[model samples]
Target: MTTAIVPDPEAIRPELAQPGSALPVPPQGLRASRNAGFTSLRVGVTALWLSVIVLLPLAAIAWQAAGGGWQAFWLAVTSHAAVQSFQVTLSISVVVTILDVVFGLATAWVLVRDNFIGKGLIDAVIDLPFALPTIVTSLVMLALYGKNSPVHIHLQHTPPGVGMALAFVTLPLVVRAVQPVLLEIDRDVEEAAASLGASGPKVFATIVLPSLGPSLFTGAGLAFSRCVAEFGSVVTIGGAVPGKTEVSSQWIRSLIENDDRTGAAAMSIVLLSISFAVLVLLRIVGGRAAKREEKAA
Candidate 1:
């Protein structure tokens, strides 16, 4: 009688016999076969939508801005009014981002770590700025803090008014960003620190702040970009005062009204470029911070 020889499965696939071994990669043909046609269609549709809404508009603006030579672009961006508007826009954006980071962090921490009555209500109200129209927010600020109000402070037509409006509109960005990070944090880690006799400030500085750094920077970057593009609120409150309260958006509007389409496009490109650079810088810094936190962990 001839005996049948059995093949050992582990001998055939040595990786399966080892602990903590990675699975073998599938063949290219098998991997390709696993992708659904519906997934490809969905990806194509998403790309088409993004191209229509974002890429096309940006390309059009760039083409318009470059219609004239580089000399024209430089002159347009460096003009007196354009320079002043850029300054105003940058100043307001910086102030708004700073304030948002401070108050937003506190609010996010409270919402995530504490339990209380009306917590749901407070959480819902935090998104009020996003739900309300920018123009409506401007009007509310005017009503509360404008001239002849009970508080008797005149913020309208001033830099502070512009900053306040920007801050109000972007307030929720930081809170929303930080809340998710806070919720994901392990409470036991905090408890372990406390049990080691670490003070509240020390614990936060050593542990909490390191973990939260990336999210805070990301939120601030988003808020700053939104502030740079703010129009309705700043126009309503800041009044487009020449060399004073006029921001880049209002300045671009003025240029377009005067039939300076090239100038307006150039200024728009400059503002867009600055916003893009800041966002890129923030991402790089945030990425580094996240890596450091992971290494420390």
Candidate 2:
């Protein structure tokens, strides 16, 4: 038999001769470290952007709010006009959100699953709210519905007019949110349900609604927040009627006009807190729904 020669283990690779051979690291480890560094860089950039854009402004508001102490903050947020403004804002937001959800879903479904003439025009028009300045939107509404117009419904200086303006502004949010989710749904699943004798409503209820729940809620929360903070349109259309049509944003503006900066900041904080709470609640509900859908799948 020929003698078999075994090459020394460390002869081929010099790294293997060291006491802590593994410490030298492999090519894969180098790539992993590079990827980790890139990820860290991305995270740092995002944090910096958020701090400058969102966190800093919020901190400034909070600090201003706290400058007057708890008693002043509490009084500012709870005064009679403030309370009425909050009520008006919440009520209109609720109405606008409901209408937006209903019409937005229908519009998204039509845009996604249907074909028609003028479809492109309609799709472009849906984004008009986003493209138009909010003040311009109020002007448009005023022109169309003011007392002098042919189709005048006299909506100016009313809660209904404010709601209308807000709904128009927020319409695109829900439609855009639900549209992508609708596009991602598999058509064959709906067909299969139909072949199994499921009615249209049954298929939609069982197959479509659950998948859309999270996105719909997310869009509603966004719309609600927008409605709450709506300033130009609400102020123009509603005219800041103290006990009747005044909303939170109008109230804040009035406070600022009166040179009550601390009160304005306090009221802003209250509005921000409410919006944050509602958004958090929606997120929790959406997460649970998403988890349930995953489990079912």
As a TM-score, model 2 comes out at 0.86
Candidate 1 per-residue lDDT, tens place, 118-176, comes to 99999999999888988898888888678866788889888898888898889899999
RMSD of 1: 6.6
- What is the C-alpha lDDT profile of model 2 across 1-297, one tens digit per residue? 999999997977777786856545568988999999999999999999999999999999999999999999999999999999999999999999999999999999999999999999999999998888999988888887667767858888888888899999999999999999999999999999999999999999999998898899989999999999998776577778877789998899889999999999999998899899988998899878878978989
Give me the displacement of residue 62 in model 2, in angstroms: 0.4
Give the TM-scores of the predictions, in the order they appear.
0.84, 0.86
Error of 1 at 84 (Å): 0.5
Q: Which stretches of candidate 1 lie over 4 Å from their true place?
A: 1-40, 286-297
Model 2 residue pairs with clashes: none
What's the distance in Å from true for residue 161, model 2? 0.4
